[model samples]
Target: MKTLQIVFIALMTIFTLNAEATEYHVSVNGNDNNKGTAAEPFKTISAAAKIARAGDIITVHDGIYRERVNPIYGGANHLNRIVYQAAPGEKVTIKGSEIITNWKKEKGSVWKVVIPNSFFKAYNPYSDVLMGDWFNKKGMDHHTGEVFINGKSLYEKSNLNDVIESKPYEEALDQEASTHTWYSEVDANNTTIYANFQKFNPNKELVEINARESCFYPDQPGINYITVRGFTMNQAATQWSAPTAEQVGLIGTHWSKGWIIENNIVSNSKSVGITLGKDRSTGHNVWMYNPKKGGATHYNEVVFKALQIGWSKEIIGSHIVRNNVIFDCEQAGIVGSLGGIFSEISNNHIYDIWTKRIFRGAEIAGLKFHAPIDMLIKNNQIHNTGRGIWLDWMTQGTRVTGNLIYDNTTDDIHVEVNHGPYLVDNNIFLSELAIRDWSQGGAYAHNLIAGKIEVRHSTGRNTAYFLPHSTKVAGVSEIYCGDNRFFNNIFIKDENGEESEQEKENQSYGLHGYKIAKYANISSGNSYLNGAKPQEGETNFVEKTNLKPTIKITKKDHHVFLEMDLDPSIFNVSTSIITTELLGATFISEAVFENPDGTPYVLDTDFLGNERDKNKPSPGPFENLKKGLTLYNVGK
Candidate 1:
């Protein structure tokens, strides 16, 4: 029995050693020498992260940690996947901690310090009171007027600005504000404060003021499927002397893929909030940069590009962008894609974007795809932007449907490319606006296109202005108006009785050869006007051309059928062509002409021979064509 007991004890000891788990605890007041247990924890999160393995959790206790910690694992390919979670109800703050070594005092009705030219290249002039007001409005703490020079209070000196202006190394720190109050000015002499604030001290470090590095890094590669969550990134000051691209915060490059940045507060950056590269050719990827870019800069020029994707390459497959709130960015709130394929961007709220010029209002485009293919943009609310949604530069085969666009300064939805099989349907453009260069081969069917439909060439020259050229051009080569179809739509005019007749004429400007059928149900109150008084309760039929060709039915069978061989030249005739063959009683339900491989044949000028002269109508073989006729239908 005693020998059995000894064997059992040895087995139990080996099992315990093999199955044991390790936990690392970090506390603000704990020492680094401690064992990192629940009762005795490490002092810093960085220390714990250094020793943590793949399946480790580092629990942080509640307190303000003023140290800037780079929690990147050298061994692990993914940097942010390592979670740094805090205990419940314990708020851990990571911010810049500036310890004042000396102080100085200055006397003035308006507390001012003249920074010497030797310290910085330029200076920003704004009173502390003004800054206080801005901070209060933004829900930040305020500062007072007492000046300190390196933690020691300064004596009230006469002409203090002059002293600082002459001295390069001189530092003036404000002590009139609370001990915790810290602010730095942008001037020559304040370079010391700037350097001092940014100084990194591992021993008793202050919170990191610049959290820009926490967002993203461009140089890294193969960083796919990583998520960074639950953190606040403070703004980093911009180096105005440097180029715009070099300005700080979360920059990405071509190789970056499958990254998800969510539930983070980013503010007060010099340039854009988040910047994405032009890497569209990278397939099967999903990347998102969301929420705020935190902090305040001296330049009112501060703007946020909350999310930027694809300025260079085409991104494809399983891309999703939704539910992000972006505001008060300088250039554009969200700028996406000059061109790409198979991408979906929807349900993002963008507002308060400002630009420098008058014609350039707060430009916020819901989805700006230049020459995109096979894309779908639906169910987004875009309002109060300079141009709500713009599709420029040969956008093809894309669908902009089911989005609610209102209160935009310019056209709600603008499509510039003229070569496309794109579909713009089921979208609500609350304002009656103009869509330019819509002569592309596609269907604008089942949509409430309430605004004035204006069609023009590239130079803003209305298609109506080219009437003389329309006559001279042979055979309506690319019937700018015809090849497309618009059916089952509603057009509403301005209810305020303000639009003019010429404007209305401009609205319904280009309707030469386009087929607008089944529009009899269009409401009378929805007036169509140009640059004239609002035509009240006027309903106009879309004039159909006599050149529309009809398909005749001939015979039908179970698996084989036949129809009249209608040549393409039949389109040039000015009268609707109709033929009644032997009524085979086998009625033709629907007849459509398709290419050999099954795509619908597009009828353009190439398909139709040529346009007849305006003075003389083109002669047709009406009497000769009546000789032989055939119509057939083949089905399963």
Candidate 2:
């Protein structure tokens, strides 16, 4: 009778809390002083966020909100969480930039603007130079500030003279827009900017500049179970998101868990777009401050330090970042370190990342993560970035599946220094270099590799690997290079004489690069075409020298299509369904390739969610794919 009474009281309390939950509204035409109702809404999102409790809803109506929304509180749990969403069929843009109209003509195509330092209050992004561990300034200074004209971002110049006498940058992807540059000078009293607007008049046109560090991010950590949905968040002056530092993005979940960021257009961040990363207390730019110790050593120490201070699954990670369009970021489209463990990143279109090529670093990519233990990255279309997906450090039990990647300047996927039981399956790798394998113990299945694969041993640096589906460090070991299993993959070589001189010199095309590997490797049922080579000591393989399949990606309206000329006879090769039992375990980590929840993964479905043949599965991402110039509508 006593136990039943206790349970009843708990149930009643939950019901009361749900009954009392309120819905607050925010609109541009509304006043903060009014009651946050549909008729009288709040003026800013920050106002509603302050008083919102668990199970509360904050609905923002259509309009541009030009302020940082710092949520003071998070929900108690995932069941009863705080939701900040745009009104249905309405467009709401949250920005870290403010419109600037004051301008003076400095030269024929140059315009100048001077503003009081009081306008920025405490934090001025113009003076905040981008710096962190593993970030190379490239002998030039770059700030976290930006100048925009009519929503188009202008390139940053180092000096006022460069802005005045602007010339097209030879290395820029779009050289014509490079001439429109901006340079800033900040002092104790005022901030001044000189910009080469070219033909546009700054006073007459819509001009904006970076005013804040982040658009929507909590100042402190432990803000958990918050949902940010259906808002166009852009143009934030975010800083460099290094693995050793507190990564602040345009919209970030700083060291938190259970955040669902979906259905929004995120773009034009000064550095990173979305960050689900660590906080400053664990270790902030320790490598930059202490160079005597190597980066790998520092990161290992940081991991232990993080574990000591609540880095478990209960407190950090498990973020859901899906169905968002992210582009035009300099550093990474999505970045995280240890705090990205057990998260799901899916169906996001990330492109045009690091295209400016102004600053070089080891951390630039479409999606970059460190210590992503049991993370699921699936169905994302990443292209035209520096690297497609960079899974660095302790990438244990992670799965990369159903992703369409192409046109990346660097490799499609770079698995660096990880003794992994990680799995890469059903992926389309279309780049000059598909895989840059610096670590070991990976399984690649049903992938269409149309580029060279570079394999190397990280003998000098030893990296950590964790227990299965957990953050507990199991062991640390230097990479022996090839404890990898490759099965049912399609390898193709470019028949056209378009190979770079360096690629020809290295001879990195196909599995031939794995010849010099130090450890054990396996390859079976892999098909090679158009002079692509097979690995040494492999028996089960297919080859076609005369078949040259031309693969290209074409965009029509909002849809992206993969146009490829494939022969249906290629499916005649024998292949079986991949499973955890066949994958075995990594030598160092002793972890098996399984799902994030420790469930067995049977590769029974194709990339398009079609069931594979039970007896003999087809190779590549598709099952029984058609021949002769077929087009696959890869959703953007």
Best by lDDT: 2
Per-residue alpha-carbon lDDT of model 1 for 1-636, expressed as tens digits? 999999999777555533453567889889888888889999987677567643345677877554445444421223323445565466554432223322223322222223343422222211122121111212232121222233222222223243333222122122321122223453424422222221222123322232223233333333333333344433322111111122222322123433344434333322233333233232211111111321111111111121133221222222333444443332333333322234455555544332211112121243344334445565555655455676643344456655656555556777653344455554555444635444444444334443555554333212111111011111111213323434323344343424466654445422321223111111111111222122222233222222222222232444322233334233232321111111011101111222212344222211013332333221221112222344422111
lDDT of 2 by residue, 149-240 (tens): 99989988899888888899877898988999999999989999999999999999999998999999999899888999999999999999
Q: Which segments of candidate 2 are over 4 A away from where they belong?
A: 1-14, 497-507
Worst 10 residues of 1 by lDDT: 464-473
lDDT, each prediction: 0.36, 0.90
Q: What TM-score does candidate 1 reach?
A: 0.43
Q: In candidate 1, which residue ranges exceed 4 Å CA deviation? A: 1-217, 220-222, 228-255, 260-276, 279-318, 338-341, 355-366, 432-445, 459-485, 497-636
Best by TM-score: 2
Query: For model 1, what is the alpha-carbon lDDT of residue 160?
Result: 27
